[model samples]
Target: MIDRAIKLWFFSALVWLVIGPAIGAFQSLQFIAPDWMNFLSAIALPYSKLRIVHTNTVILGWIVMTFISAALFMVPRLCNTPLRFPQLAYAAGWIWNAALVLDLVLIWAAIPDSFWLSIQAGEYAEAPLLVDVMIVAAVVCVIASLHLTVFARERPHLYVSVWYLLGGLYTTAITYLVGNFLVLAFSGEGYQVIEAWWLHNAVGMIITPLGLGTAYYIVPLAAQQPLYSHRLSIVGFWTLMAFYPGTGLHHFLQMPVPIWINEFAVISSVLLGIPVLAVVTNFLATPRGNWSRAFDSYPLRFAALGTLYYLATCLQGPFQATAAVNWYVHFTEWVQAHAHLALAGAFTCYGMAAGYYMFPRITGRQLYSRGLASVTFWCMVIFFPIFYIGFTWSGVATGASINLMGNTIYQTINITWIPRLSRTITGTVVVVGFIAYVWLLLRSLRVGAPYESGMNEVPEMGIETPFEEARA
Candidate 1:
C-alpha cells in the first residue's frame, strides 16, 4: 500500500514538473516578446494570471508534491513501521491534484464579466475561495496520514528526517491557512504587511523545510554513510523553525512598515546562515571517505550540489535583505535570479535527486541511462550559472543606471537589453535539461534494468545497521 502510494505521488509530481516549467518557459518567452502569446488572451488570461499559475504549479505541484512523496517513502522506512493510513495518502494525492487543476482553471477562466471564479489578487495565495477550501481539505488529509504514521513508529527514537517531515507538514498547513485566509482579515497598509509576510513564509516555511528535510534524508543514503553529526541536525531543525517565520518581513523593508519589523527581519535573515551552514556542513562531511562514490552516484551529486546552491541562495538572501543592497536589487531582475536560485536551483535539484534515488527503488527498475542523467545534471550546472549571472548582471546594471546615473525606467531597460537577452538564451537552454530529465523518468519506467531489492544497502559503510536492527 505504501509502495503504491509512493509511486502515485511521485509520478503525479513528474507530470506537474513537465507542465509547470513549460508554462514558465512560455511566460519567459512572453517577456522576450510580449505580443507573441496572444492566443492565451483569448481565454481571458494574461501574463499576470499565468505568472501565478506557473509559480503555484512549480512550487506546489512539482516541489511540494515530490517532497511529500519522498516523506511518504522515507517516514515509514525510517520509523520501522507501515504507513498508518495508506488510503488517506492516496486520496490526498488526487484531491491535491484536482485542487491545482481547479486553480489554473479559475485563473484562466476569470473575466471582468464573470468575476465569480476569479482568484484573489494575493501573491502566492491567488487560488479562489473554492480552491482554497479544497487545498485545506487536502492538507488535512496529509497531516492526518503523516501524524498517524509517526505515532505508530516501532522505532523507539525518531530520526531527524521524521522530525522535519512532521514539523513541516503541520507548520505548512498553518502557513497555508494563515496566508490564504487570515491575511484577508486586514486591508489597507496592514494588508500589505500581512501579504508580504505570507509571500515570504510561503517559500521559507513550506518549501525550505521540506527541501532541507529531503536533502538530509537523501544525502547520507547516497553517500552511503550515517550523518556526520546528529546533534547538528537537531540544532539545524530548531534554529530553522526559530528564524524562518519572522524573516518574511524583510520583503517589505522599503515600505512604510514599522522600523523594528524591518530590523528583526534583517537579523533573522542573516542568522538564517547558521542553520544553512549546519546542514551543508553535515552533508559535506558525511561523504568524507566515499568522495568517489559521491561523484559516481548521480543522486549524491544532485544532493551535494543542491546543498551548495542552498548555501549560495541563503547567503545572497541576507545580503539582499540589507537596506543598502535591498534599495538597489529590489524590483529588479536580481530578485528573480535569487528566487530561481532557491526554487529552481536548490529545491528542484533536491526533488530531482529524490526522484533519481527513489524511483528505481519503488518501481524495481534501474534508470534508463546514467549518461543521460549526467547530461541533464551538467546542462543545469552550466546553464543555471549562466542564467543567474546574466540576470544578476542585468539587474545590477539597471539598478546602477537608475540610482547612480539617475536614469529613467526606459533608459534602464534599454541599458540592460543585452544581458536580458542573454538571460532568455540561457533560460531556454536550461529547459532542454528539464526535457532530458523528464524523458529519463518516463523511459526508465518502461525499459530500465530490473532492480533487485535491498541493492542500495551498504554493509561495509555501517549505514544499514541501525535501521535493520530497529526492524528486527
Candidate 2:
C-alpha cells in the first residue's frame, strides 16, 4: 500500500539522517582530536575518504531517497493517475537500498583516494568500479520513475514541478557521467579543478532544482492559492537552466583556470540572484492580503521561512563567489555554514513541508497532527540561526586570526585547537536540532490524530478534491 512505501522511504531517510550526522560530528571533532581519538584513529583511514562517505551518504542516500519518496507520492496524484508499474517502482527502491549497502562495502574495503581520481579519467577500478555501477543503478531507478510518470501518461500541459523533476534527473545522469568518468577520471593535472567544478554544478542543478520544484508545486497548493504568476515561474526555470551550470567555476575563484571561465562563473553566480529573487517575488505575492493565512497554517509557515532562507542563501551565495571574500572564506568553516544553510535550512525545509503536505492526500487519510508539524517548523526556524551565527562567527574570527598570526600561512594557522573545538560545539547544536525534527515527525506520523472538523480546513483556492472541499 501507499502507506508502506511512504513509511519505508521516510524511515530509511531518517536512518541516513541519524548516521550521516553522527559520522559528520565525528569528522568535525577530528580537527581537535587528530591524534587523540584512540578508538577512531587508524593509519590507513584518511579524513578525505571518511568525509566523502559522510557527504555522499547525506546527499545521495538521504536526500535522494527522501526526494524519491516524495516524488513517488506526488507524481501519481498530480497526474491524476496511479503509478504505471508499482512493482517496478518497488523493485527500484530495493536497487537503491542495495546500492547503499554496496557503497558501505566499498568504503570498508579501503577504496583508495586514487579510485576517486579515476572518476575524472572516466575509468574505474575494482572498488570504485563497483561504486560507479551502483551510481548507474540508482540513476536508472530515477530514470524509470521519470519515464513512468511523465513520459508514459497522457495529460494536459506538463506541470512546472514535473518539468523541474525531469530536468533534475536528466542533468544528474549527465553530470554523473561527466564528473565521475570524463572529467575526474580522464583529466589528471586538472582533475581536482574539474571535479570541484562538477560537484558545484551537480549541487546546483540536481538538488536545488528538485527541491525548489517540489516546493513550487506544494507550497502554493498548501496555501490554497494558485501560483502568483505562471510567467514568473517560466522565467525562473529558464534563467536557472541557463545560469546555474555556469556558476560552478566560482568555487575555483583564485585557482588557475582559464580567466574567462572564472569571470564567467563569477558573473553567473551573482546573476543567479535574479531567478532567486523572481521566485521570492512570486512566493511573497501569493500571500497578498492573506499573510495571516501563513501564520495560521503549519505548512505555510514552513514554506514562508523556506522562501526567506532561499533569499538569504542565494544572496550570500553570490557574495561569497567574489575573489575578495573567497580569499578569507574559501575552505573555511564559513563555506560550511553556507552549505548547511542552503542544503539543510532551505532545501530540507521545503522537503519536509512537501512531505507533510502530501502525506495525507497520498494516503487518503488526514494528517496525524497539525500541532506537531507546527512545533517542527518552529524548531527548524530556531535551529538554522543558532548554527548559522555560530559557524559564521567562528569562521570569520578564526580566519582573520589565522591570516594575522604570522608571515606564513602555516604559522598563522598553528593555533587551531580552540576554533576546532568551537566547531564541535556548533555541530553538536545542529545535531540536536535534527534530533528534535526526527521526534516531531515521528509523533506526527504515529501518535497524532487527524484534525477534527474546522481544524482540518485550509483556505480556499479551486481544489476539487473531496478532502479539500470537505475541509474547506
Candidate 3:
C-alpha cells in the first residue's frame, strides 16, 4: 500500500521532469532568436515569463516532487514500518500534483487580465498565492502522514538519512511560507531583504538538504557500503542548518540593504564550505574500492557522477560567493552555469539514481533494459559538460567584456553568441537523455522482467543487496 503511494509520487516527478526540461529547451531558443517566440503568440508568453515557468517547473515541480518521493521512500525503510496512512500520502501527492498542473494552466493560459493574477511577484515564488496555499495544505497532510509513520516506528534508532529527509520537510514548510507569504506581506527594503533570503533559502534550505538526504541513502545502498562516517553526516546536517540562512544575501550584494548584511552573507557563504566539504568527503569516500563496478551499474554510475558534480558545485560555490568574485560574476552566464552544475548535474542525478535504484524494489520488476539506461547515462555524461563548459565560456567572455573591458551588455553579444549557441545545442542533447530516462521508466512497467519465487535478485541489479537477499 505504501509502495503504491511512492509510485504515484515518483511518476508525478517524472511527468514534470519531462515537461520542465522540454520547456527549458524552448526557452533557450528565445535567447538565440527572440522573434521565434512570435510563433507562440497565441500563448503570448514573453521570454521573461517563459523563463519563470521554466525555472519554477524544474525547481518546484520536478525537483521538489522528486525530493518528496525520496522522503516517502526513505521514511518507511528507515522507520521499519509501513506508512501510517498510505491513502492520505497517496491523496496528498495527487493534490500537490494537481496544484502544480493548475499553476501551469494559470501561467500558460493567461486567462487573468493582470500578470499578478496569474502568478506572484518573486522568481520561484511566482506560483500564485492560491497555489501556494493549496500546496502548503497538501504538504502539511503529507507531513502528518509521514510523522505518523515515524511515530509508529519499530526501529529503535533513526538513521542520518531519516534525520535529513524529515528535517528538510519541516524546513521546507517554514521556508516556503516565508518565501511566498512573508515576502509578499512587507514592502520597501524589508521586502527586498526577505525576498533575497527566500531566494537562496528556497534552494539552500529546501532543495539542498532533500537532495543531499536522498543521495546519502541511495549512494550507500546502491554501492552496498557503509556511510563513510555517521558523525560527518550529522556534522554536515547541523552546519548546513546554521550557515545556509545567512548565505542568501550574497546573491543580492548590489542591493543597498546594509554593509553588515553583506559581510554576514559573505561570511556565512564561506562558512558553508564546512558542510560542503564534509558532504563531498563522505560521498566520495564511500565508493573507494568499488569504482570499477560503476561502469556496469547504471545506478552506481549516476551516483558516482552526481558526487563529482557535487564536489565541483561546492568548491565553486564558496569561491564565487566571496565579495571580490561576486562583483563581476554576480549575474553573469557563469552564475547560470554554476546553478545548473548543482541542480541539473548533481541533484538531478541523485533523483535518477534514487528512481532507478528503487524502481525494482517498489514494483517487483527489473529494469526493461540496461542498454537504454546506458544510453541515458552516457547522453547526459557526454553532453552536459559540453553544455556547462560552453555556458561558462560565454559567461567569462560576457563578464570580461562588461566589467573588465567597459563594453555594454549589447556589446558583448558578438563575443558570447557562439558559446550561447553551443549551450543551446548541447543542452538539447542533455534533455534528450532525460527523455530517454522517462521512456525507459514507462517501458519498464510493461516489458521489464518480473520477479518470481526463488529469484536470486532483480535481474537489473548486478550487486547483491539486503533487499535481494531478503527476497531470496
The candidate that achieves the highest TM-score relative to the unseen native structure: 1
Tens digits of per-residue lDDT for model 2, 278-340:
789877877776777776666677778888888899999889999878778776778888887
Which residue pairs in candidate 1 collide? Answer: none
lDDT of 1 at 281: 89
Provide the lDDT at 184 for model 2: 34
lDDT of each: 0.83, 0.67, 0.82
Q: Model 2, residue 89: displacement in angstroms?
A: 2.5
Ranking by TM-score: 1, 3, 2
Question: How would the candidate models be sorted by lDDT, starting from the highest?
Answer: 1, 3, 2
lDDT of 2 at 338: 86
Candidate 3 regions with alpha-carbon error over 4 angstroms: 39-43, 110-117, 452-472
lDDT of 2 at 445: 57
Worst lDDT 10-window in candidate 2: 117-126
Reference-based TM-score, model 3: 0.93
- Model 1 lowest lDDT segment of ten: 456-465
Compute each candidate's TM-score over C-alphas: 0.94, 0.85, 0.93
TM-score of 1: 0.94
